[model samples]
Target: MKKILSILCFLICVNAFSQILSSNLEKKTLALGEVNHFIIKIDNLNNQQVSAAAKNELLPFHFEEIKDSIGTQPNLYERKIDFSVYEEGKFTIPELEFKVGDKVLKTIPYEIEVINTAQKGDQINDIMNNKEVKLEPKDYWELYKWYVLAALSVIALIVVIFMIVKWGRNKKSSPVVATNQTLKELDSLKKKKYIEEGNYRSFYVELLDISRKFITKQYNVPADVLLTDDLVQLMKTNNTISRDNEKIVEDVFLRGDLVKFAKTFPDKEIMEKDFTDIREFVKRSSNDLEFENLRKDV
Candidate 1:
């Protein structure tokens, strides 16, 4: 009996504290207009980090917290939240999320039970004021027909202007020096917040665009419209890019296709490697272009 009891206790303790965070309410059942406390304790904080205002989305309840309280120890974290109910029967306390690096931890949904405390005499006024009325749908087509037409006309004009502007741009030739523009765009890409926000597809698309545009402008070939396999074959046929540079561009294009069309999200390490490959590919391809320039100058 003692051994069995010890094992059960150990299991209970392990189950209780194994999670990254735990939340509990001081009193789940409270009278309306009464305040109670809710607390959250986080463990293993030394091994992970979380957003500073992690609980912002879970709160601003029916009534605000009495005090904003937070405390931390060497490897432990706790936040005390006091909230009051105004009018409620059963309400769900929103779920909370804690982001540790790239992973998000979510707590189970919590519900609060609030019992109305107002007496019959206090509710008499509310009962007297209660009334029901039918909601009849009205036809607003006649009232706003001209207004809708005017709004749509404005939208059509804007779209026509946008298309005209786009067409003008397409007819103009780019005059940017390939090497300088490629490096400039790469620096601009690094400053973008897409990778930080997990927008892998957008980042990859822009990276690949710079690559294909550079190839097209420098080689005077239409590289952007070709499929990845076809582009690789064309490069090999024309000796446009070295075997190593061809691999780098092909790999980036394949990865970008997967991310943009397949909706596959790559982790941070894969994204960082792709960024490095893009830089190297641009540099090597630029060197090839420079060699062609030197040959012509000769």
Candidate 2:
């Protein structure tokens, strides 16, 4: 009888201890706006390793294992709960139940109070105004028409002024008088015979000036201000002369530069070649306009 009584007392003590271990819970409280944290630690009382699947029955919360170097136990699981609520009221974090094989463990409920924050700016007014506002289509064509009319008026005024000036110039002068004046100036210079006297540098300079003047009068190109390269590029872009004619023009300018700037003494043959190139260029270009006019007349 004494032996049976001792066994019953030992069994009751063991059951009480098991109930106390299973009912262990960790509870926490925090403000709504504040960062809230809760931790539930479970020490593995069993001899075997425990899995996190044992805590899957928790509501409104979840648990993750924590790695701690100071703990002697191998399976010390930690469950952390973060409470996040925007409303200003009391909220409850439900109890959690973790199952490991045949045994179950329960965790306590957590509570948090959420409060409203003070907001600045006219946010409600801006939202109401934006919702009521209506956009109207812009009339761009009406605005553009005035600009187009103004541009046309300016162009017409310029054309009238140009016509009046051109008509006055043509009416006051004769073509024959202009032609005679230019020819007489050239003739007087030729009679000076500066080139035949071996003044090659001066001769080339005068030739370049005369060619520039003729081009300015005949083609309306600003030949006096143009460099040889600029003139060549212009001629090529304009297709003003044939390939053969362009080569002749280039050679004349190059040879003239050598004589005037480099002080190059050319033989009689080269001097004669330069004169021939100049004469041919002038004759060909001058005749082209008349030929074009005749074709138009026909």
Candidate 3:
């Protein structure tokens, strides 16, 4: 009786530690170029001990991103994968499996439908005829008032320019003032302790904003408006900054994108180096601009 009772207790304890696996899809149907999430959750398992020997095959759908995180419980792990399909069709999401300890957990395969709304219909709506409007004296004034304001604006701008030039002759040029203000902004960002608080996303956002503004001001380039590739291309084409400095800025911008959009956290050392690189770029670029200005003046 003692041996039978001990065996029963062991079986009960084994049942209590049973592993669970589940999978979920955000949506069954998605438009072309639209993203969807596929999530896999495992309970009573540590992700570190789990090995994905067979990779999930996403044939029709293009795999965009994948991220994993611990769930509500310490023993629970969750993985999210982002995918999109360019061609419209029904595709099967292959079964995913992972080995946790001695047990292998598998997720059942599911079908996802990809759709293209643009090719759905050929019906074209008729274009309505334009309506004619009668204009009164007030309407004429409203139309021509812009010209009047423009003339006044031009006159005001000329007067303002004259006053600025006269004031400038009395005041000595201070290029360092702008550079100092930029450096002070960087110093203020450091004081915020964003990295210490583990708010790397916000830190990168603000860092990129400040760097873009500095680039725009120092190089007279539209850094804030242009995309990363476009901005890099413009920088290379203009050759206002050295290739090494441009590469540094490009790397920082790409890392910022990964942090902001992809939810990736880079190494703390890399983050610090990016900040330092941007600071050095500002100072070096400013000095170069000042030298060029002085040469022009001479």
Candidate 4:
């Protein structure tokens, strides 16, 4: 009795895992150049990474975009594929086969038809000229084939040369006012909507990256890769920042680190203070550097 009961349980478990493959077509008939949507569904299976892999014969038809698969239930997934054939005729969608965990699943063959709407001396509804000309038998690319290829090659070469010259000129330019650019970047960041939407983490990350870049450029320090404490120490030892300014930097870094590393959501008011602190530090540092440069010239 026990052996018979175990066999029945195994059969029931296998039946529960059965897979169903199906397809949904948005339209059976379409105009040439128009697209048709196919939504494929696989039911009663655990998550296997699913993507639209239709057979090679289905080509000549352009497959639309491969969308991210959506799981509606524990074992239900839907994938969408859009395809269009340029030719006008009845064509059957070959069986779409998908391999799922040592098993193969496929949908039944389906058919679609393409029809041209022009009837009885009507103009071809294409966006081109209304007048219809008699079809001419000719090698389409014979006239401009070499000319088109040559023009494209020349255009590509010119773009490459221009970019090289621009990079050379910038490499030889005078030293940039790093703090001014950093301040501008911060102002632009402030205008973004991250904080308004409660994305405090992103706001903190952008703020920290700008500060690191500024420190690297201005003081010639590797602050971009340094931890907060190390960066502050380097700044103080080099006298890059003033005594009062050190406290401001420390506060900003502490708050930013809390948000980024500790996942602490800071209040908007406190974040506003950090913003003001950074702006003040940049302004003072810029003024001090400019004054020193003038004194040296004298």
Candidate 5:
């Protein structure tokens, strides 16, 4: 009888100090940019206070976190946190520690798989695929009438100017080279703050445009007209730009293409690196071009 009583007392004591910690995710897999719900529950709190340090918690990059609850009941404690990652990949939620009076309880880490929803099936479509909509004839007329009127007005103005000057002598003027235009434009691009605004696609498009234009003018290569692969090939053939610099340009173009076409958003560190490398590439290439011109003049 005494042994039985002792066993019961031991069980009671264990229950008083013991806590049940469990972490649950609504789904292990999610579509890109979709929120995943996570819940943490603790039972048998025994009236002891439960608290978690905010500084100890860390989330994946670009993942939005929404804390729903830090619930407390007579013997129960629950926390709900929602997380969503803009980029697709496998991400983990690290173990969270909760202080219960003197002791700390930690939850196990959870892995989340994020996949692109648009590329789920065997059939692959463009990320920016245009959907066709059937419209009435009146709708087409309504949309295009203003454009037609604008085009006709432009044509009439051109015809009038041409008739006024039947034949004109062309004057050849010396072209003025704009100094450090690409670097100045890069500074202007920074002022726009497209990345901070979450307009990554626009940022990449403009970044590529600026780089391509610089390459075209500096190397006399049609970088703006060539495809990314073709332009990278052209850069590879250039003896003036070092192989390392060529790789930097190639990486930037390829990553930019992914952002523009595949809807991929890289971390800010990579974006900053691309910006820095492009600036370096432009500076070095500009100096090389000037040196070549000086040698030719000599």
Candidate 6:
């Protein structure tokens, strides 16, 4: 009775082990550019190990195994394949074969369909070869009119050149009499001892006027009409002086305004500095481009 009972138990275990080796896949159809996944269940009987391998003839794909428990009962293994197809046709995913000990299992064959869009008719060549219509040329008389106009322009140019040359010679022969007169007036203003006598208002006003006359004679600019800010802004815009000279010009005018209108009393040192600044500004303007032609005669 003991022998017979042991034999029955051995047969029962073998039958249970064979059943665990069998597996099944989820689907057999897929669309192009889609991912298809399936699970494989293996009964780990007789201490058997499970592994998977694949071969494909048409489509490119990837496969991966899923994790499961390793208990006495059968466990599930998963496989995933990605199908990215460009052409319109049916494609086979090939077979994914799994091996467990001496037993071999295969996943079901899969089919994928790739659809393509229709193309429009060709109109590119028609547009590329299209040309515009040309206009007819003008008559000979119209062409002759352009030559007559050009000849007249040359004569006008010659007459203008003669006048310019005559003017240049005259200018070279004569000194800039206006600049000389303005300088003499400035020298007279400098000779006055108004600031020394504590007449700050008269001194600043006359100093500014002399400087303005010099600028007007030398640069042909109306300095008398421009305020201190306007003068500085104009110089900066025209790039007439260096940044340092611009600051000096601004300081001289601003200080002169304070002494004249505000009746602000400055020390002897400041009075001397203002006098020097005004003299220097006049000398600089006398040498600028507007006065350069006159300077050549001198």
Per-residue CA lDDT of model 6 for 184-296, tens digit only, reads 87678667887676566677788778767666555556677998888878877876554655677688778887654332456567888878766665555534554445556
Candidate 1 residues 95-156, lDDT tens each? 56555556666556677788987676764345476678654444467667799999999999
Candidate 5 structure quality by residue, lDDT tens digits, 73-164: 97899888787777778887766667677777887878888888774467765989799999999999899999999999999999988976
Error of 6 at 9 (Å): 99
Q: Each prediction's TM-score against the native?
A: 0.40, 0.38, 0.54, 0.39, 0.40, 0.37
TM-score of 4: 0.39
Better of 1 and 3 by lDDT: 3
Where's the lowest-lDDT run of ten residues in candidate 4? 51-60
Error of 3 at 118 (Å): 14
Which is the better candidate, 2 or 3, if ranked by lDDT? 3
lDDT per residue as tens, model 3, 43-87: 876434654422233222244444334344568777766767777
lDDT of 2 by residue, 1-298 (tens): 9999999999987764442222222334434445555556666544433223222223332222232122225445555544344456667655555444456666666565556555666365444444554434445556587998999999999998999887855443432443455455555656767657655656677777776776656555677899888987886787545566667777877778665533245545676677666666665664545554576699
Between which residue pairs do clashes occur in model 2?
Answer: none
After superposition, the stretches of candidate 4 with alpha carbons farther than 4 Å from their true spots are: 1-176, 290-298
How much lDDT does candidate 6 score? 0.58
In model 5, residue pairs whose N, Cα or C atoms come closer than 3 Å (at least 3 residues apart or on different chains), thus clashing, are: none
Per-candidate Cα lDDT values, in order, are 0.73, 0.57, 0.75, 0.70, 0.75, 0.58
